[model samples]
Target: MLIEGFIDTVRPSRNYSEDSVGRESVHPDQLDQLVRQLRIQRNDDARCEVKACTSDLGSAVWDSVSAFANTSGGMLLLGLDQESGFAPAPGFNLDRVRDQFVDGIGDGGSPGRLVKPPSYAIERGEVDGAPVLLVEVAENDLGSKPCYVRAKGVQGGSFKRVDDKDIKLSASEIFEMQVALTSQDTDRRPVSEAEIDDLDDALVEALLDRRKGSKALRGAKGRAEQLSRLNVTTKDGIVRLAGLLVVGRYPQQFLPRLLIDVTVHPANEKSAPGEPVRFIDREQCEGPLAEAIDQAVSVTARNLRTYSTVEGTARVDHLEIPREVLREAIANAAVHREYHQLFQGQPVTVDVYPNRVVVTNPGGLWGGKTLESLDDGISRCRNQTLMQLLQSVPVADTAGVTVEGQGGGIKMMIHEMEAHALDRPRFRISPDQVVVELRRHGAEIPALRAWLGGLSTDPLSDYDDAALLVAKREGKVGVTDLRDLLRLDSDDIRQLLSDLSNRGLLRFIGGESYELWSDEPRLRTSDEQVIAALSAESPLDIHELSAAVGKSPNTLRPILRRLIGDGHVTPTAPATSRSRKYLRTR
Candidate 1:
């Protein structure tokens, strides 16, 4: 036995428990009250990991902790024998085992020192009557990462959590991390060899003219002062990476990887394959970021096909997809792409399909951002200097929008697409790139556009447009039905629905999960017809009831379920059948 009793090296903050047992997460109220709920089947899933009782404390366990700290935050539970259904290890010494475990892991743990500037919080807690030491490892800051075992050094010592195991980070991964941590952005470095002549005077003048009266460029006397104020000119009076990339005569000459390449693919969703070439046409846009963004958007818009849709009677013509949506997406790929990293001959790529458009750039979502959280509008810019340089540059077509770096462009893209009733934009992070796709939904897009054009002066977010779409088609919507609508999570669904209700755009029953909405409430959503058809003994299925309600069965399910839940009707005997009938209870 290692020892007995307990020694907590790092006390976990209150309420870290995933079980939602109570207000407190530490020290379960009762030993048995764990509810036997700790599930540890996978070797090492996203968060929880189970270590065997007889396992060596130094190597595998500490490596796992370092990997967790360096990747997403994870849990390390010791004293659980995974081979035996992960029950508590027999004869596990609480204090002695914890001491061994804690000794090898911290911000700077042991000879290998997995975590640096260490801050791995450890807690001694019980689960199913077992002494398990919970090592809670949070992902280190981007500036403090690539936490590696000191003995192995950064290249070999660093470990990252893949699917379930701690895999050693590749040399490239380590280099990237080291570069990212040590140099948050390499764009601030001035090119000593480059001179004032390297930067294009026209580009500088254009930028200055665009921001003439703006406070961003106030009191600037000359090009040097202007560049100095923007922090693009170093103390040596040489152009930095930011100034060169944004206004230099040839940014690609200075940094070959700094350009935008857009390709127009020629396939729709359901189509035969073409010659396997990436696109039917291609263009390499090589200017500063703003001009490149504009060129890319212009070429992409030119190659796409258009269609006409009649809204109530007025015919509105648009690209198969919205132009502004594509513009915004392309702008995003250009403005936020990493300039220092090797593009491997691939610059930003915007692939256009007959029915879709995808804008891709060289870099994953930076600083620990996941795809699911991108829509929340939390942004971490990879090129801080580049982003700041565009502060005075207005987005080409967006009147009040500029490269303000507020992260609103993403939301705007989603909103515009949602309003047009086109497909929702999908953002994904692959190993080496970030992709944003805007796909067209066949012919439904025409109707979607018309429906959108009919709205008043109000600007609808992606969520509102989605709720309206559901309401228009079905006459009713529920919180659960709108899960795929906006970025707000389940906790905020009620607030969203209530906000819509207060705006008179929707109406919901008190505390009910469903909301009532309609363009024509009487003809489309009136439930009286549904109620009238029911009697004391006669019930009807959705298909049969749809005729009486004058609404589609698919759209009537919520109204029917709500009516039933409130005792307005009762099901026939032998309930729960697919063809079940109902009776009026009231």
Candidate 2:
């Protein structure tokens, strides 16, 4: 089978019209194209599901309702037969099926109500003269998440769409969604398993001394009252999770996984074999958050190998990854990680490779922040209480300065890396975690220049060289990546990419992305893979082709050029435009 995993399944047609409620609904003629796509795939996908409910509506439809609402919204098609290549079902009753679906999703008190807080738009469409019902479900907000079947309740009925399947959500996942809706700080919650005496005497004294200028400490009558006023203790004298994490003598006794783990690998990639042991050094730092951050940094720094350079006739030695970068990366991971009960078992990790160091924490960007916004100094605190406490809790051996709480850690890391003439740290973000990779500036320029020297006779500009390097490293380079790298506007980047594609140095990879061009024919093993992928669905661009073939666009460019020359493929537009696409030649 062709590699279709990288491509999103066919989307419902966008031909839309406003309904009585001002919501956009799909037009009836749109069903024809959608049906053809469904037939070609011969299966359902994440965005659209097919059902052939001809006689009556049942529990299956409600399950999809919950799944679509809980995850990204999707289209639910009724009277479509999944068993027969999604053809219109035999003996389908369009009006009856549509009425039943409407009643089931209505507000409370409806006899057929199946879901809570219904959010959908319905339309009646026909394909091949067969009537069909299309319902577009909307995703619920955090407060209304885990939208479940009314009969099954949230625990048993809640479902989320994972690819083509509707999977039941775990209790912990539901609890996390509920917790996220609350206005209170999650770290301020009392740790019922922890005691007041769990707070370390010296650490607590240090914290109190640091906060001496605060009005809360001055207004308290005694130590207990002082701790309570400072949000370190609940009214019943139980230690709060944030306070325990900051000053508790043994916070891990109650929350075992709230720590940092560090590991040093022998090579750049984990797949490198022949090593007797997986890690050269491994250690888990526990105790309070401040101490854990410090220890993790120390362990990672100590394991690193340094290099020397001459400055002003003097030899200067520098750690592979700077000490400040390590500390900032570790501290950010500890402070910003999600504190919800669902993620309590997951610990922050720092992995040291020969060429880079990767630090990961159990949470993606919170509060709707985007990766592009990091350079803008936009900050969102996932753990406000923990951040507040850390703002005053000085590092153990520092000169009276706090660890890090001003929301400048990312900016500092960027500045430090740029100052050293190293590439800015790269971030990998997902729903489960956020990882930052600090790469060593190891001969990248020399290697890229050496590679480019053979590609062209004319001398290329520095920006062209930089863009090619990015495209080679990252499978493809997009307008956004170039903007960040070159500090150029969208139009300039587009023009530059077009010029490169014209000069045969880069290939436009659809969706405003480009990759390096190649001319080696012996390295064209992906010829069949590309053909197979396009055969399944025509008119895929270099971006989709590269992702599907699991090769860089640079690798596919030469193959595509040869295919077009041999009449095996055709371009949808001129090669200069970023939107140019390729398909099997008719």
Candidate 3:
């Protein structure tokens, strides 16, 4: 019945024999060879008179149809000159010729004929002024053995595919062909005895809710109407695969593997340890998917810790771990997990930790989707029906959040983490496992420090010491002045400033208008002593400083300016004809 529709879609202009359908255009040279092999009379099935209006058709044409349908269907072009090699020469009455071919094949009484009459269409066209008919045949789903050829007296025969040849089927082979065809019809029978109650109610509710506010179901009228709208129920009122997945009282009744498993472990125990790891609490939950997801989320939330920062005055810590992100990730895993793990006792595993959480589900990146593609929002859901159902239910936060069946959850989770300055979630895949690890913000930084600590011999740089020295002795020093004084670069100086400020050793003040750093303590450095000594006497020009310290003016200018900026020195007078002078800020 389905094949009939396909036939109508692809109308062929002429009827072709099973074997001749896929025959390549008969070449002008090959025509002679073919004629010789068939031992046909010179003009039989051959284009006689390069432009003749009519010619006798060959009986061998039927075999072409059988050949094509048995294999990948092909087309056969007729009315072209085989001897002259595709030279356009219109032949007599193209429609009549096509009708004759169709009638001959459909006659059914022809010797050794078993070809199912193919539906064909006819058209008139000119090939270099020569009439030609195109016959297209479709490959039959009849497996590898429905083919046949003219035999002594038999109507049905057998054939086999050899290297570009159709070898006749043996008697034993013909018997086997009959057996296969008889069983094929029985094998494709529709599933029976399936009922609506076999579907998971939660799953159905979820699916309907997914299309909320759509006129598609007339608001589903009620549970039965909703099931009918989803095409989960058959005309005879039996439940289908889609129905069994959602709102079914017992989905496992029809599909036993549709359940999920959620487990929680204490801080130290994965399995029972020699000494049980004391947990504030621990629980394992399992059931129809919706309940399992809710319980898992609740447990995860209860176990997670809320972190606070010095800027607590800014925002509250209601959710340390994003609830929506976690819910979607968990729901996606359950919906997409492979339900056919034969020996595996569990389908999904949710492990909760004090500082992190891990969800492992069966099956890896499916449908050509890889980790890279997952992050790029390439989604492929292996179970479309189940996915549609899950979509109906409201997401944790809203009624209409759609989970991308294309595996976009990874990107979403990463985005959420980035929002909180948290580490990106890690994804790993093994033979039959897919694992996602969500680490709490700042949890891994300390471990990284400990690891780096063991790998080095030198102590880490102490920027605070440098910042304090510059601040106490130099008072308010320009960044460049501080760098030169400490023999550091701009970057190192900036790092010192930032570290000091973060540790409460220093504070930033002033707007961008006129920024300055001031000392939180009094002077204690040799440089401080030098500046104090010079300033206490009076302000001195670079030349005066060079004379006093017995150094070049170039060398003395830097130290004097730093002192002046640090408030250790004050200008005695503005620029004058002689030289500018400075004094200590007494």
Candidate 2 lDDT by residue in tens digits, 1-586 = 1112111322322232234321333454456667777778788888788889868876688888888877777888788889987878998887677667766776323754454544676666676777777777777765676678888877899888888899887766666555544554779999998887789998888878888878877778788988888889987798999999998998999999989999888778674566677788899999888888889988988877665444455666667567899988888888888888878999999998878899999865666555777657666777888888887788887755445555677888886665444678999864457899999755454454467776676666656766776787787888888776666788998898898899998886578987777664322356767777775246888998888889899988888888877677788899788998888766
In TM-score terms, which candidate is top? 2
Ordered list by lDDT, greatest first: 2, 1, 3
The lDDT values for all models are 0.66, 0.75, 0.53
Model 2's alpha-carbon lDDT is: 0.75
Return model 3's CA RMSD, one decimal.
23.3
> Which candidate model has the greater lDDT, 1 or 2?
2
Better of 1 and 3 by TM-score: 1
Better of 1 and 3 by lDDT: 1
lDDT of 3 by residue, 195-277 (tens): 56555565666666666677767755776776666566755566655445445565555445455545556563365656555
RMSD of each: 10.1, 12.6, 23.3
For every model shown, what is its TM-score relative to the native structure? 0.62, 0.65, 0.42
- List the candidate 1 regions with Cα displacement exceeding 4 Å: 1-43, 53-55, 79-96, 106-112, 117-136, 141-144, 170-185, 192-201, 211-237, 263-282, 302-315, 341-346, 351-407, 422-443, 446-468, 477-586
Once fitted onto the true fold, the runs of candidate 3 whose alpha carbons sit more than 4 angstroms away are 1-194, 198-242, 250-260, 268-275, 278-284, 307-315, 341-344, 395-408, 441-586
Question: Per-residue CA lDDT of candidate 1, range 1-586, in tens?
Answer: 1011111324334223324222233455422222143442324465666676564564666677668767876766677777666677887765565556555553124443454734545565677766566656666766677787766777777787876778887654565565543336567878777788888777677667777787767887876887777767886688888888777788777667667777776566323455555458889888677777778878988886666545554665677667778777877777666655455356888877776777888755566666777767777777788777776555455544336677677777776675555567887764356888888765676667567546634555556666777777776767766655554577677777777787777776545444554554332235566677878876787788877767897787777777776667677755457877777785
